[model samples]
Every structure is written in C-alpha cells, then in structure tokens.
Target: MKQLVIAEKPSVASDLARVLHAKEKKKHYYEGKSTIVTWGYGHLLTLKMPEDYKKEWKTWSMDTLPMLPKQFLIQPLPKTKGQLQAIRQLCQRKDIKEVVIATDAGREGELVARWILQYVRYKGPVKRLWISSQTDKAIKEGFAHLKPAKMYDDLFYSAQARSEADWLIGLNVSRALTIQYGDQLSAGRVQTPTLALVRKREKEIESFRPKEQFTVELSYQGHPLTSRKPLVFSKKETAEKVKAQLQKETAVVKEKKVKVKKQWAPLLYDLTELQQVANQRYGFSAKKTLNLVQSLYEHHKIVSYPRTDSKYLPTDLESSMKERLQAVAKEFSLSGTILQKGKVQQRKVFNDQKVSDHYGLIPTEVAPNISRLSQDEWKIYQLITKRFLNLFYPPYEAEEQTFVILLGDQNFQLKQEKVLEQGWKEKEEGVSSLHLSLNQELPIQIKVVSSMTKPKSRLTEGQLLAQMEKHHLGTPATRAEIIEKLVNIQYLERQGREFIVTPKGKQLLTLVNESLVRPELTEEWELHLQKIEKGKEKKEQFIQKMKKEATRLVTEIKQSEKEYKDFALTTKKCPECSGRLREKKTKQGVFYVCSNPECHYKRRKDLKVSNHRCPQCHKKMVIVEGEKGAYFKCQSCSLTEKIPDKKAKKQKMTKQEERRLMKKYSEKAPAENPFASALENFQVQD
Candidate 1:
C-alpha cells in the first residue's frame, strides 16, 4: 500500500512529488514507489453559512439580532464539492493505508486540512509534512522527518477556536449592525479592527493643529548650521528677536561628538510584508500583490509560502541555507557575485524564534521565467528574488561622522557618513534598505558651503507608514490594504501618495467606541496570540474571555443610540426608485444604493475589472466570486476567467472612450457589417 500525501496547493504537492520520485502522474495524483502525492486548492471544506443550518435566518430582520447556534456546522464549498468527494474516495482506498497532511504549517492551514479529515471521517493513521520552502532539499528533508498528525492537536484546536469566535462575533455583530442601521454592513474580527484603525487615524489627522515654529541659524568655519533645538515662536516678535540675536553673533561649537554605528540587513520578505512594500512603492494594491505572489508560487512554482506571516526561517532550515543560497544564486545569476563578494549571511533572516507557522517567502529551486509573468508579477517577483539574494550577503558596515563648528557664543553642529563596505548591501547590489542608518559619532569629511533653518515640512504618508511598519502594528501584507480601505471609505484622501484623514473618517471614530478601534487592542491581541503559540496560555480560557467581551460589546451597541447616521451621508436620491440613497459599507468599499426594495440599483465606488463579452448574448460579463479571489463570467456565452484589477493592467483609457468602445462592441450589429461603407454612402459626391 502506498502512502498518500496531500498539500494545500498543487505547487507544493508537485515539489513533494518530485522529491519523493513520484514521476508517474495519474489524474491529480503522482505515483511513486511508496508514495502518492496530490493537492487541494486552498481548502476542500469550510464552515456552513447561517442559512445552511436554518433557512429562516436568510432574511435580514431585527428579530434575529443575535442568532447563535448551539453547535457550528461544517460543509464543503460548492466549487470544492467534487474535490471533497475525490478526497473522500482516496481516503477509503485500501491501497492508501496512511495519509500525510502537507498543507501550510500555520494555524489556518492546520485547520483547513484537519477539518477535511474530520468531515471525511478518515480513520487511517496520519502524518504531517511541515516544510517552509518547496525547494527540493527542503522537501526531501521534510519527508525524512515527517511528524505524526496528532502532534498538532493543540494547534488545530486553536485554529478552530479562532474560526468559531470570528463566526460568533462577526455574524452576531454584523446582523445587529445591519438590522439596526438598515444597511448591508458586515463586521469581523480582522476587517472591523482594521477599519477602526483607519477611522481613528482619520480622526487624528482631522483634529490635528499645526504649530508654526522658528529657529536661529549661524555660519561658522565656512559651514552653516542651525540650532539643534527648534524654537517654537507663537508670535512674530519672538522670531524677530531670535533672528536679531544670531545676526551679528558668531556661532560657538559647544562640543564635538562622533559615533560609529553598524547596521545589519533587513529581515526576509514575507508575503504580506512584500505586498505592503510593493503597494507603497509601485501603487500596486494589496490584492494585486497577493495574486502576483500566488502566480510566482503556483503557476511559476518559483516561490515558497506566499501567505506566510514569518520573516525568519526556523533552526531546521538554517542547516540547508548553503544549498538553498547556492540554488538561488545559480537561478538568479548571482553565482559570480557570491563567489567574488563572499556570503553576508546573518542571523536576522534565519532566526528560529521568529517563525510561527512557516518561514518567510522564498523562491523554490524551480526557475522562474521572467517573460511569462505580467508587469506587476515581474515587479513582485523581483522584490522577492532580490530580498532572497540579499539575505545571503554580509552585514552592511558604515562609519558615521559628526562635525561641530565653534566661533563665539552661538553653537553649530552637523553630521555625515559613507558606507565602509557594501557587505550584505552588495547581495542585491545597489538596492537600498527601507531606512538609512543615521546617528552622531562616525564622521566623514564634508565640505558644507551652505545650510539654513527652513520650515519643516509636514510628514508624508510614506514616512508615517515607514514608522508604523517599524512598530509592527499590521504585517507588511495588510498595511497597503488598510491604507486603501481608508481612502476608499473616505477616511483618508491622497495628496499625491500622502494620506490625510477626512471629516467622514474623523467622525467615524467618534461614532465607534475607542476600545473597539485602538492600535493597543491589536497589540494586546498579538501579544496574547504569541503567548498561546508558545503554549504559555490556554486557548480555551482566552477564547472564553473573547466570547465574554464580544457579548458585552453586542449588549452595549443594542442599548446605545450612538447615532451612526451622523457619519453616513444621505444627500442624493436613488436614481432607480427616487428613494434616499444612504451610504452602505461593504468589504469591497462604500456604495450608494436604492432604499426601496422594488427598484434595485446600486453603484460601487471601488474599482473592478471588466469581464469578457458574452459571445452568445452579446452582454458584458459579471464578476464571479471564486475560492481564491474574484473572477469574471460572461452572461451571454458562459465564458469564465479570473479577473484582475484594471489599474494593475497598465492600460490607459478615458471614461468617455471606454464607454464609447463598450457601446460599439456590445451593439447588435454583425461583425461582417462595415461602418465605413455606410459612412461613404452618406458622404457628399465630392
């Protein structure tokens, strides 16, 4: 009897198959001497919806404000029905005596595979293949030390608790909010808290008061320098007084201080972190980057775990770094660089303690074709590839320097520095890290001819984002999406890429309680989750507390008439039914819809891609939801394809031009008919 190994996705399954020498492919499974490898598309099963359990809860009504079931139900998604049936059949097959769970190493991944096993009622002995990257070496090693599936019972339980809690709180809260507000408002643990952060930031930006400041500057020893402390002057008289004092005074150097600092390379790029960086740098959406990374992992089979949260590899992975690095160097054309410059390998990218479920995203040994990927895919791929290469290089070294010029009483000080050695910086060659190392002490010879005290500019959104990233509130993966949501919901607006909160955003914070939307809430939860992962806290007790808190929050919302309408706008009438069109919140973004049930017309503010035209019915396609993301279906021809955002498509078309083209193409006229012939006939004889 052969052992069957199932993975979360085809790429991983194929990698395992190759490592196991399962070259003989049959249907979805790869058959080897002693193993058979197969894969699932993310998940083959999921929790049943409210209506699935009971049909009465389908309609939105205040009476069903807090619909809580005694026990949750599990069911296969409609699309995964066939896959589930196949997996069940495979489980019962006599030849497949043992099963292996080769899914992701995270809580969610554990839940995904375990739930299916429970639903199928597979009684066979189970094994778990926990590997970070799909590199051949990693896969071979993972197979050598596959652990018993029962070892992850606690992790599975934790994953289930999270899912159930989200359902309990999300469903109840969503229903209550929607029924009370008479809008299609849905809330969840992740999405709601994320929204709250955006709303809070918006409030701070709106209420922020800018204070004008004045400072004195002086020229000494041919180098201009300003006062280290900025003097905030409430009145122009104070500014004039300070300016007059420094006008005739020669600057004195109080003391000269110089310090040398050593900087290490940044941690490896995880999926979310990579997504955030690409979004901030190239204006690619979070969803866009996710899709690109998925392609890099699946279609290209060139990147490891794209949905991972960890930026560091585990201890087990460290032993294989040389082989992994060598593979990457060969594939990415960096062998010469590595040989000439030597490795800058550091502990930052390979620490075992930092990893929770899986290590950072890295490309598999499988080579990536640069030509096959789209422009956005190439951009994201380059980011991952470059970071991977840089991780193997040496640490960055720089000598920082400080200079202080003394003349009379007034003091002047300045600093400058240069790289002592490229070190790890040379791995990605000239690629710059997020933050440049800056401090006093290490000094470089500088010939400064001019310097002046100028008005300090307001912080850019990029700078704020960089600061937030350093603090680690949201992962690299979710930051872009969070920012985009704020802008979409009118919580923030773009002044070139800089984010500033709007009035609506500010008002949203006041409408919601501070406890529900503060950064500290997320920080607290993160701390607890980390503790739970380390087995320092009990999952059941933590979940019980969450349930209590959720219950309390629900009760409070029901009693208070906090007036959410104060933030929601109702300025325009619905075009379809002449009813007041109110602001309705959704995961996609905000929308304006008809209040009347009879006339259903709504316009989404968020962007969606155009679908293919129906060949039979000659109508534009509609966006269809898929397991992974959204897709497009042609209503006329029944043609279906994955839908990517138009913004990421790198297309240029004005609204008028798009509408004209759509109308022309969607017309009832046959393709054979020539518009030129008709125009010629209508023209004058001359």
Candidate 2:
C-alpha cells in the first residue's frame, strides 16, 4: 500500500512529487511509485462565517454583535470546495495505508492539513513529514523518518484554540464596533494590535518637541576633527550663553583613541525580516513583499521557504551547505575568494533549536535560471539567493583609527579613514550592496588649533532601532512588522525614516482602552507563547487567560462612554434621509453613504477613467476617491472609475465636486465590463 502525502500548496506538492517520484500529476492530486501527494491553497476549511449559523447575524446590528457560538464549525471555502473534495477522495482510497501530513511545518501549516483530515473524517494512520528547506535531499530524509502525527496533537490543539479565540474576539468585536460606530470597521487580533501600535507612535510623533543644539570643531593636518556638543541647559537663553562662551576660544589637541571593528555578515532573510528590509529600502509594504516572496518560493523555486520566522538553520542540513553554496556561487559568479573560503559552516547561522517551523530563507540547490520569472520575481529571488551566498563567506571586517582634540574645557573627536576586508559583502550586488561605511575620512585644508567641544551624534533609523532592540519590545524578526503596521494604520507616518504621528491615530490611542494597546501586553503574550511551544506552559491555561482578558475588554467597551466623531469631508446629506453623507468602504472603492441606519442612500462618486477618458462617456477624466482607492471618472458623463489606493479616502475632495468630475470625464466608448456600475454596491453584505 502506498503512503499518501498532503502539502499546503500545489507548488509544495509538486516539489514533493519530484522527490517522491510522483510523476503522474492530476488536477488536484499527484501520484508517485510509493506516495500520493495532494495539496491545499492556503486553507481548504475555516470556521463558518456568522451568517452560516443564523440569518439574522448577516446584518450589522448590536443585537447580533457578540455572535459567539457554543462550538466552532469548519466549512469548506466556496472557491476551494473542489480541492477539498479531491483530498477527501484521496483520503478514502483503500490502497493508501499511512497518511503523511506534508504541509507547512508551522502552526498554521499544521492546522491547514489537520482541518482537512478532520473535516473529511480521515480515519487512517497518520505521520508527519517535517522539513524547512524544500531541497530534494531534505524531502527524502524527511520521508525516511516520518514521525507519528500524534506527536503534534498539542500543537494542533494550540492552533485550534488560537483560531477559535481569534474568531470569537475578532468577529464579535469587529461586528460590535461596526454596529456601534455604524461603519465598516473591521478589526482582528493581529490587525488591532497592529493598529494600536500605529496609534501609539502617531501620538508620540504629535507631541514631539524639536530642539536645537550647537557644536564646535577643530582642524588637524589635512583632516577635520569635530567636537561633541554639550548643552548646559534646555532653555534657549542658556544655549545662547554657551554658544557665545564657546566663540571666545579655539580648539586644542586633547586625546585620540582608535580601534578596528569587524562587521559580521547579516543572518539569512526570514519573511518578516525581508519584508522589513524591503519596506525600509524599496518602500514596499509588508503585504506586497510577502506576495513577492511567495511567488519566488512557489513559482520561481529559487528561494527556500519564505514564511519563516527563524533567521537560522538546522545542523542536520549542515552537510548540504557546501553543495548549496557552490551551486549559488556558480550561478551568481560571486568573488573567487569567497568560493575558495572552504565552506565554513557556523552555528551562528544554523541552529535547530532557534528554528521552529521554517529555517531562514536561503537559495535552493537548483541553480536560479531567471528566464521564466518576471522582473519582480527575479528581484525577490535575487535577494534570497544573494543573502544565502553571503552567509557562508567571512564577515566584512573593517579597520579604523580615531583622533581626538580638545580646546579649553570642551572635547572634540574625529575619525581618520575606513578600510574594508571585502569578504562576504562581495557577492551582494545591486540593491543588496552592504552599507559598510558612511563616515569616510576626507582631506581637510586647515591648521591644527586648540581642541573644541565634541558634536552630538544624530539619530538615524538604524540607531533608534538599536535603542528599541535594547528595550526588547519585539524581536529582530518582528520589529519591522510592528513599525510597518503602525504606519499602514495611520498611527505613524514617515518623515524621512523618522516616524511622525497622525491626529486620527492619536485620537484612537486616547479613546481605546490603554491595557489593550500597551506593547507590554504583546511582549508578555509572546513570552508565554514561547513557553507554551516548549511545553513549559499549558496551552489551555494560556488560552483561558486570553479568553478572560478578551471578555473583560468586551465588557469594558460595552460600559465605556467614549464618543467617536466621524471624520467625513463630504457636505452632501443622505438623499434618502436627513442623515449626513460619509465615506463607506467597499471592496470596489469608497462611496458616499448615509450615516443614518434607517437611510441606506449611497452614491458612486464615479471618477474612474479608461485611457485618460471616462469609461461611461468619452471625455477627459479627473481622479476621485472610492472604497478601493483612487480612480479617474468622466466629468461630463455620469460615469465612475476605480483607483488603487487601499487606504481610505483622503479628506480633501468634496462629494458633489468629485461626482461632477467623474461624470465629465466619462469614456465616449463604453467598456465591455458592465459590472463596473454594479461594483459600487458589490460589498459582500455579510
């Protein structure tokens, strides 16, 4: 009898098929000599939507706000019913004796496979194939030593608990707020914490007080030596007094200390870390980066697993390091010196204990041939491949010398030059280049004088991050995500790399319950979750606490009398009633809707254009905000267009003017897609 293996996605199933010799591929299944591989697309089954339980819960009403069920029910997603059915058929096959859960090796992955098995009531013996990297060798080894699925029962239970809890809190609270506030305000465990973080940062940015300081410097032979500024007082009068006193004297030679420092190659990219780096350097959002990385992992097959939190690898895969390194070296033609460095496998980059579900993203053993991949896929693939090669090479070591001089009672300092070792960083190309040295010594033309006061070091994002790292609000893996979430939710805005708060975000912080928004809450939760993973803490206990906290929060919200004001920019009142018109977001785009519950009046604000002309009637178009984003619509014709800004409508445009511009720019020739008009009301009512 053959062993049946199930993977999370078709890409993974295909990879496993190749490894298990599963050559015959079906639409939803793959057959091999000794294995049958089937796959799921993310999730095949999820907790039933509220409307699935009862009809009345379909509409947003305070009456149905906390729609928590006595027991959770799993139902196949409408789009994935065929796939789920195929898996169920495969499970019932008489020849398939032992089933292998070959899905993702993480909590979500475990849940994905288990839910399908439970939903279908698969009653066969079960085993688990756990492997991070999807190399043929790793897959082969994993199959050879498959463990009983019962070993992961606790993990499954934990995942289930989280799912149910998220459903209970997220769905209930989201519905509650939407009903109470009378808007489509969706919130979830991840999104809420994310929003709170943003609001907090925005608040900080709003209250920030910028101050000015002064510094003095001295000149050495052909080199500029700068002094560190010391502010004697926070008052402007004292600052001016110090500046005047400093002008009376010149700088003098004081003391000099210089040393060499080594900069190690960065650990390999995990998904979150990669997202952070891409966001900082390329301005790509986390979701965009995740989508890109997923393509590289599944479609390109150039990068290792992307949905990883670990920045390290397992020691068992250590033996394959040389071949993998050599493979990347041959493909990228990295520095000859790096390839010759004798594939040094260091524990610093590979430790099994540190890696949970997936190891850090790395290059696959297969050589990356980018001919089939799109430009974006190639870019993401290159990032992973280059980072993998850099890890094996030696650190980018640097040697530096410092010269210090003092004038009067103040001290000044200067650096001579930067010298690079150029080992691992050599392989990095394009945007992947290392930012080794920014303070390079320049030739200065001035005579040596008395030492001056030292200058203050300005804070960079990197520097502020160093401080955040010390505080330990989040791990290196999650810091970027935390920061990005804040920005996306309008809690924080970037002034260069510095974060600035926004008013709405500030108001959110002042209005929401403080304990729910505190960073320590998540920090503590993380610590406990880690313990639960290690079996040091009971998952049930942790969940009970979370439930208790959630209930208390809900109760508090219900009792609280905090007032919320609508931040609408539209002047038009509801056509159906006297209620004010406000922006209501739909999947299609934003539209003006009546705030009154009884009045459901809405307008498309149709500013969408096609080929610079409105789609409805041929004319030039003007851009307007909709639920989805921004779009150009005909001003003359009663036509609308859709735009792509995911954030809600900006406050500038008025409703009537927006609608007028959209009609004026309507396309003279109509487009074939008739649903464009229907999309304004296309929200999934549930």
Per-residue alpha-carbon lDDT of model 2 for 1-686, expressed as tens digits?
89988899888888889878889979888897788999999899999999988899897666665565656799999899999999889888889998899987777788999999999999989999887566676688888889999888777876776677677666776566555555544445544454554444445555666654333333555355565553334455655566566556565434445577877778888776676666667656555677787676666556777777778888776777666777777657766765666365334887777887678888767666767877766667777777777676667765565655444586556565455676666533322221223333323323212223333333324433443443345444345565666555555566764544555555555555567566566556656655665567787677677667666666666666777666754678775687788765455666788877677777766544446665566678777655575667677875765654557656688899999989989845454576875665488866
Instruction: Quote the lDDT for 396 in model 2.
Output: 70
lDDT of 1 at 498: 50
Clash tally, candidates in order: 17, 53
Cα lDDT of model 1 overall? 0.66
lDDT (10s digit) by residue, model 1, range 462-538 = 54455445545554444556566566655666676455555655544444445655656655655565566566788
State the displacement of the C-alpha of residue 135, model 2, in Å, after optimal TM-score superposition.
3.5
Q: How far is candidate 1 from the true structure (C-alpha RMSD, Å)?
A: 11.6
* Candidate 1 displacement at residue 544 in angstroms: 3.1
